[model samples]
Target chain A: MSNPTAAMLVIGDEILSGRTRDANMYHLAGELTNNGIALSEVRVVSDDRSAIISATRTLSETYTYVFTSGGIGPTHDDITADCIAAAFGIPIDIRDDARAILTKHYADTGLELNAARLRMARIPEGAELIENPVSAAPGFILGNVFVMAGVPSVFQAMVAGVIHQLSGGRPLLSQTMRFMVGEGTIAEPLGALAADFPDLSIGSYPFQKDGVYGTNIVVRGSDGGLIDAAMIRLSNLLPEVTDDPE
Target chain B: MSNPTAAMLVIGDEILSGRTRDANMYHLAGELTNNGIALSEVRVVSDDRSAIISATRTLSETYTYVFTSGGIGPTHDDITADCIAAAFGIPIDIRDDARAILTKHYADTGLELNAARLRMARIPEGAELIENPVSAAPGFILGNVFVMAGVPSVFQAMVAGVIHQLSGGRPLLSQTMRFMVGEGTIAEPLGALAADFPDLSIGSYPFQKDGVYGTNIVVRGSDGGLIDAAMIRLSNLLPEVTDDPE
Candidate 1:
């Protein structure tokens, strides 16, 4: 991969139990792609200790950046921060910096900074806090692992805080060509187009809208010229094709 | 885990690239949970062959059943069947049964049964087909892995076809208790409730609606009575709490 590689580890039983849909992963994927980072893998494990720690260790070691969402809230089930600490064999507790932020925010909101809320201050040893403007509880970055909240709005905000700080390569460029034909009818030429432009990533997505079968041919690469070249070939291969997003 | 453990290996570049969100994982998670199977882990990898093969082998070894979505189409990007075959050391080719299904469907639809379309008929040596009512190109069952389509309708149809054949434990039971207070305000007593009901999985999720902060406490277990008992304690602990889904 030309760009930096990343993996998202989504931690929560709510998702595993099918109670909640995955929003953070989708948001992070778009942000990473826009920042020229290739999201290579994603894993969703329930709020279990061993599973969390094992996934953290593997993803942290494998990818350039590992972003985790969920399990950092102020509840007993919120064990992501502790799992990160355990994954790296680091001691974790309510850090002074995080505790201060929570204390100040809770005081302003008129909510008591009790032990439950105080649990949010538990940060891994020697980690930098990622600012949470939405909620006062901060996400911490331990090594390459960026631990954030599960809530979609909060996760998106934390990403905004973290994304600009990291180094990025050239943003990936993509173009789509729509053909009013099924994937089976267009597969052979699409495969040929993919082979011709070995550098670009070409994907065929089929859709059925209003009883009409169509396929979207998406070509992605950092080089605009190569993507254009691939799309031109696709258009020539199918005369009726349109370079449409719809 | 009292219920059978299952893992979902999502094979596609579309999800990782942020061009498409993960609808299949969410659908499968809910379906698996309702069928008395505990969806333990989910891994989403790109269209790369090695990544697909590695994930397939790992999840197959770890979980009781492995369900993979995407990459079963006729396009060049569709390499899931080949990857699954490679992972299990099986030779893959267009089987007569799958070909017959496709042949009949194409004859009915008046679409050509060309070589590109025939790629969908490639099945592993010993695999049984998972019928696709939405589309004729069938998904297949190879050992513990159930390879299905990426399209939501087709994947759901394939899942419905396969879910009933598997032996399942009792479906997981769950009850929700809502407190008109923040998670921080209710975390301690909720932790105590969780401790008392060791067999139950208790979770606290915070939400903000119309600027009002509240928390939803979800209690889940195989036994309905245990879930009810835990919910009662939660009500006793917080008298303002109501069993609400919203």
Candidate 2:
């Protein structure tokens, strides 16, 4: 069976404006890959309601799972929850369950639950909350869309709560063969090897270190035996250049 | 006049597979911002031809400028050039000028101009080559899309060749005010400040460093005087929390 496909939507102006480098996308990508879910695409849009709504709808319909990060904070600029509701044509209010979680968490810290703080309690109708262990604010899952916090710590915690529930396929396994030769020298043979194993994804990544050029050829597939066989063939193809023994 | 909007399309499977963290998007975002071009959106898609072609078309039509990085190498996975041509309904083949550049560069190193190496010479009709000083493989520009190499050094070199040609608007100026207060404590007042200055973008980013919680309130706008005025008001509003003294 084919692996479940996923797409990520990152909503923040700080990312687009170059004020902050996004950590959530990279973390989630690694997490999803480990979970045997193929994260096919990632879209980063600014904190705009229309853009968020449009991207959410498109990704939700196109992929098996759609994960969105950011814009779910207490600040005025946090409009992701409202946008998610608008995308699904649902009404959103301060759901009692979400409010209770936030209220208790804030009360324990001796912080007032002001209007801005209460904004975190707003959730779309017919949605399930994704618990945030690091922070009190809860992420929510509406349909296939999982809405999470923008902060790296909170996003990671929320993902941990929800990832185990999703169905996953065979985890993709990868083996790397490092060679001192330039990519140009190995492209032809690598191309041929790729054609021979159509199911495996063969990637050539070039690196320059200390005035020496090298390529790391990665062979990835679900089947360990096929990948091992392909690796042996690849090492044989470049006997002198490969670092691995025959 | 509004700043010219831009979008970035990162074409790579290594990114989706969690093998590589994307550095090009962050680099380009800062470059575009400094150049007065508003980078509004960024999409990271795999090396799939259909995905690349579809994303190219969508971004090209929506934004003033579209920058694409990766999948322009000589390996089997390098399909960006072909996909770009397909997106524009243009035929691509080995152009003599591009082939000559590669041939001369390789000849200096005593490397053979094999078929795989020659693949870099393929350029779409009516496209101009963007010089890669770091590597011989040239990136191309078709319409408003500036196709760049994936390697950081080569991509930066190629961008330097073409960035001066694009029309840029006012540079986005920003000022940051740091406070050792919780975001929830100031959200209501910050929201009022945001409503007062609709033209300026006010963003509150919370950070916890060495067990101390703080928020960096950033005011961004094209007008320096307005941002300065807003900063004064902000300092006045949060005298005790702000690092700045009254």
DockQ of each model against the real complex? 0.62, 0.55
Q: Which lDDT tens digits does candidate 2 get at residues B3-105?
A: 9999999999899899988888888888888889999999999989899999999999999999999988889999999999999999999999999999988
Candidate 1: which stretches are off by over 4 Å? A240-246, B240-246
lDDT string for model 1 (A143-185, tens) is 9999999988889999999999877778988999878888888
Model 2 spans with C-alpha error above 4 angstroms: A242-246, B242-246
In the range B36-140, model 1's lDDT, one tens digit per residue, is 999999999999999999999999999999999999999999999999999999999999999999999998887789899999999999999999998799999
Q: What's the lDDT for all of these models?
A: 0.90, 0.90
